[model samples]
Target: MSHSLSMPASCRASLRTSFAMSGALVATALLLPLTAHADQQSSETPAASGETASYDTTDESPRSAYLSDWYNQNVTVIGSKDIRFGPQKIDDIYLEYEFFGRKGPLDLYGYIDMPKFFGIGNAADSGAFDGGSPIFAEIKPRLSLNELSGRDLSLGPISEWYLAANWIYDWGHNSDNRQNTLYTGLGTDIDTGSPLGMSFNFYGKYQWENYGAENENSWDGYRAQLEYNYPLASFDNGASLFYAGFTNYDFGSDLGDGDSTRTNEAVVATNAFVYSFTHLRFLAVARYFHNGGQWNDGSELNFGDGDFRVRSTGWGYYLGVGWQF
Candidate 1:
């Protein structure tokens, strides 16, 4: 027998109301620092002097420098369903938290994804014992080689280069279902200088993975990404915006077992519409995925009875809210 689950009307309405209130709080938080800065500027301005004051361009205030580096940092909380988008679906609610920021020159980005606090649905339907309960975390830190070397590596369109490393951990419902992965890569950042401020990234990565089960895998791959954002319209309090990105990955044959069948390839695309208030952002996102080869999940290789059957393609949607600091 098969079954389906859906959120009730009242629960969805309550979630919508909570999101509205959260957005208002985020806006207030974002405005307070600006308001303080404005007040400080007003108090510091010289009183009605006959002579005009000249500004110094070389010297920058400590507060201004700090704010420049940290003001745009943000954390987003999202509620999503069927994040994996599969033939075997995880129908329960899931919460994801993402963070993006900079610590000095190194750029940091990561997300934590897990099911809701309370578990719902039957054990078999939830994949409780099969390593499909969906708990994953990843962190990537990229060090700018150009900045560290104090040299410009720009070659026509490429603007910056970096040495990147990433660590990922995945946990299934049981202790026997776990995987850890590490990746080191060379990457470049490109600025297109277009009307939409489009950007691109290229990466050549070597990946190593260890699964709790018998089989393990390693491979080399290259990834390409394109990203852009546009402002659609403005309102008295906020603005509507559109953002989109695409990513492609190509991997070589498995290094450990020398099996071409164990290699993986994938392409993913995402689009979102965001509404921005004083300090908060609300967004709706749609994503598409195309997968091929034995490691279709992009993390580990799965072997079936006598062949590989992991290839899949699907789409999913998410609604989220973010607070900028």
Candidate 2:
């Protein structure tokens, strides 16, 4: 049966609210390629002989101390469906403009997405021209603590520390369809002593306008994230095969209202494979969501006709073709 027809009206409304607030995660999938590329390139760049290591003295160095900078911009088409996080699943296809870079003390990543760009989705979807939110964007920035303090705070196996923040915004026509969220905390890059690169971050979440969800306008949960990137292979033509991914675990949130349908914890993990070159790229991603959007798995929502079981745990897939600039 169609989710639109089978879902109770109230549950449907809650589902919309949850999906609107959580849509920022969709933009997150766009981050892997650029992040992996930037890190890989920076790591492979040759350093000058006798260069002062970043972990040297506590003296405040110039803004260009490290002297390595890299960035990439790309546009991609992405599609996914049947990944549940609410009363039903949301199917969406979006056009994405993404950018990421590292310069001086800053590491930054961001993207903008136009949902339903191809006018393909289920009834729950709001097309770009339709009443749904037209644009969703997310920005993540990390400032090196070592750079800012002019000190090398690297511990064993930890190469760098950062003050990291993420902000998400959805430009919808009304407050009920809009979302604004922030995550702030500490982050670090790990030294694996091999080709594999890893990063970890922990954040406290603050919710602003969450599509009228109960958690709106308050401090909500905490999230722990881990990311990894590896260069699987490189070709003579400069095209390369790369593997990258991230995992997020969210906990300690109280959405108010206290409905049995929702929980305080959720998790999502994603893996990506990219075949990239200077001018073009191809990407495939697989993701797993458990208790997505904090919706309880196997919980029943009772309405007029019968009870419907929520399906919030499952696998989601994304495919994209991109042009790098």
- Prediction RMSDs, each to the true structure: 11.9, 10.9
TM-score of each: 0.62, 0.78
Q: What range of 10 consecutive residues in model 1 has the weakest lDDT sum? A: 18-27
Q: Local error of candidate 2 at 288, Å?
A: 0.1
TM-score of 2: 0.78
Spell out the clash pairs found in candidate 1.
none
Candidate 1: misplaced stretches above 4 Å?
Answer: 1-77, 85-87, 118-135, 173-176, 202-217, 253-263, 292-311
Q: Which runs in model 2 stand beyond 4 Å of their true positions?
A: 1-28, 34-69, 301-308
What are the per-residue Cα lDDT tens digits for candidate 1 across 20-85? 000001110100011111111222343122111111113354233123332133445554444333
Model 2 agreement with the true structure over 1-325: per-residue lDDT tens digits: 1011000111111111100001112223434433223223332333232222121123354332222224545678777667564656678777887665556777666677787889988875775688777787777777889899999899999888988787878887889778888999988877788766567778999999877678989999999977665568765444567666667799989962497888889887766677765446677777788987778888888646578888889987777787655
The lDDT for every candidate, in the order shown, is 0.39, 0.61
Our tally of clashes for model 2 stands at 0
